[model samples]
Target: MEFDLKKSLEILDKTPTVLEAMLQGLSDEWIFNNEGDETWSPYDVIGHLIHGEKTDWIPRLEIILAQQGGSKFDPFDRFAQFKNSEGKTLHQLLEEFKILRKHNLEIVRNKKLTNLQYTLKGMHPSLEEVTLAQLLATWVVHDLNHIAQVARVMAKQYKHEVGPWFEYLGILK
Candidate 1:
């Protein structure tokens, strides 16, 4: 499907709403709660997502638009950036994400994709080039992927157990 910039902005706007709901009434302890060392607690995930939106995705979009090549861009390490950040609560991170997302949506909405062709250049890890259209489409997909992940995690965390219902129905011993 063709990338509709306006539609993408509408979809991206949902991220902050989801983040706000997921974080409502969450305490510091809950934010830090993790199933294991490998699992990211709710707080970690928010921090990572905020960093990804601001530092990685939005900046890359700007780079793609500017068409100024030759500067090396590093693949962002979300976890590392989150760990290094000094914030004490997820609220701050969420607010930052909300602001950046709004700014990015504005930029995307005002952009004229037709008659625009730009070459992105990079060779450090590997060389690659992409058009503006391709970049916008990729970004929309990226946002959707993260939004799905957030939804799945929230479902698992908030879903009520059905064991009692299953037992009453003779589906379990």
Candidate 2:
């Protein structure tokens, strides 16, 4: 399918609400629970998303928009949230993410980028050149991938409890 900015923004617009709906009212235990492995808990996922909000998505877009032949994006620190989210509760993280996302979306809308601009190129640290369209598309899909990850990690907390049903539940596997 062709790239549709409006459709993309519509989906991007709902990510924070979707995250809140998935996480609200859960206890700290549930939010932080994991399978005692490398998988990220819901809390960790939120922190990671927060880090992205601050350093990844919109920052990269701004670099692309402002720099001729596009500037090289700073290498993303995937684990920065471990330090950045220090002293924050899940509710605070959620609110911060929501606000940052809203601010970024407003900037995107106000820019009123044309299809030609979406084709604009930027340098990625590892991937070399990338298009604005690809970056935006990745932003949307990245949110979804993490959402699925949060669900999978949460579901796996019951890996042993689910017993025989685990084989049938793809999320558990």
Instruction: Please report the candidate that would top lDDT against the real structure.
Output: 2
**73: Cα error in model 2, Å:** 0.6
lDDT of each model, Cα atoms only? 0.63, 0.88
Per-residue lDDT tens digits of candidate 2, residues 35-138?
A: 67666789888999888888898889999988765589999998888788889888998999899999989988999999888988889999999999999999
Error of 1 at 138 (Å): 3.1
- Candidate 1 at 149: error in angstroms? 2.3
| Candidate 1, residue 63: lDDT | 68
How well is each residue in 1-173 modelled by candidate 1, as lDDT tens digits?
65666776667778788778777677765566654567776677777766776676657666665656554456767576456446555777777778878887776667655544434433222445555556666666776776655555544443346644644533122
- Using TM-score as the measure, the top candidate is 2
Over 4 Å off, model 2: none
